[model samples]
Target: MVDNRYTITVGTEQFRFTRDQLESDPGNYFATYFFGEFTEASQGARELVIEKDIQLFRLIQAHLRGYDIFPLPDAAVPPYMTKEVAIKNLRHDAQFYCLGKLEGTIKDLEQTSVKKEVKNGGKSPLARRYKAGECVISSYLQTWTFQEINNDGYQLMLDKLKNIDIAIPSRRPQVPGFSVTFCWVKENYYYALLVSDD
Candidate 1:
């Protein structure tokens, strides 16, 4: 029961989208393939078979539909979908499809979700929720796992920080110490890092 359209078969699933829709964002992989050309005359053109993950393909469609894959915070997730699962899926999809524009959207959504968590009361269950670029005062330090500085060289310490659960910030987290790189300073307190050693 499929209406005629640009049918892309991915795994066992098939999706249909108009040429206009597929060409909407020429910057995207699929759009680029069909744009500025006689797509109808392209070799073996009737159907495109995708060998990658189908879950991610859905994310691409969602983005084309609304610029972002997420529904409103209060909206019910569609059948077979949830916000967390969708975000995770779309990230892989964006990478596979070379949909680079979606990277910023994903980061923005993650930051926004965490901020909402903080504002609603504070302290999400996992310290891993702390994103790369965020800073916090000593009062909320419990949400993060701070590491102790040892005699190890700065590069070694920096490497260790990478293994920590700190969510990679949009710009990457820096120890930024004199020897330690550095992060932020407040009052008389100074800390080069905000992630737990756990």
Candidate 2:
């Protein structure tokens, strides 16, 4: 079943709607239109402040794009009080696994990390290699593998890289901080990794 129950807040007013209600009369346009206007108006703001605040816009867009927002079962009110805030939180949540991959590499599967098992496992040698700072290129002929991971979030990024028709090369940036850039397969977004040495 499609888990609905999304929290939408307009100004100070917040409402939770199930999938049936969202799909029934309101159609999601109300939420989308409001956020669209909000972002459009903010485009002219100073870049520094805008950069910090654009997350609000992203949160709304993610919902309109049909991403599911699951509230943590134990939370009080839901981490997000507004639609924009929810999207930002979802994006952050989606990133957790991807960030875990990078963090796993950074910690080197030391004695005290949760992902030490995945790191040491022989199954994903490529991930292990990439974690160890080795550069590698891989390609996949089938698109199904890519589609299968649509909901896996950014960790699916690696699978998408694998599915590219042309060679997708990945490299660890020489500098410490977490930025690795590879060739462009789609557009301006480069296949990259953010790694930190601990």
Name the candidate that leads on lDDT.
Answer: 1
Q: Which 10-residue window in model 1 sums to the lowest lDDT? A: 125-134
TM-score of each: 0.47, 0.21
Per-residue lDDT of candidate 1, residues 1-198 (tens digit): 955467778889988777777765556667655543546436536566788556666667766655555653424333345446556566767776666667667878778888998998755435431222334544554243354433223334455555565433222244433232335443433335334332
Residue 184 of candidate 2: its Cα lDDT? 39
The TM-score, computed over Cα atoms with residue i paired to residue i, of candidate 2 is 0.21
Per-model lDDT: 0.55, 0.35
lDDT of 2 at 100: 33
**Deviation from native of the Cα of residue 156 in model 2, angstroms:** 1.2
Evaluated with TM-score, which candidate comes out highest?
Answer: 1
Each candidate: how many clashes? 9, 3
Residues 1-198, model 2: lDDT tens digits: 854455554444444555443343232343333333457324531111212233343433334444532332223223224332343344454344233322332344333343654566533322322221322334532121111111123333444455567644442235444344333333422234332322
RMSD of every prediction:
13.8, 16.7
Candidate 1 pairs with clashing backbones: 132-169, 145-195, 145-196, 175-182, 176-181, 176-182, 177-180, 177-181, 177-182
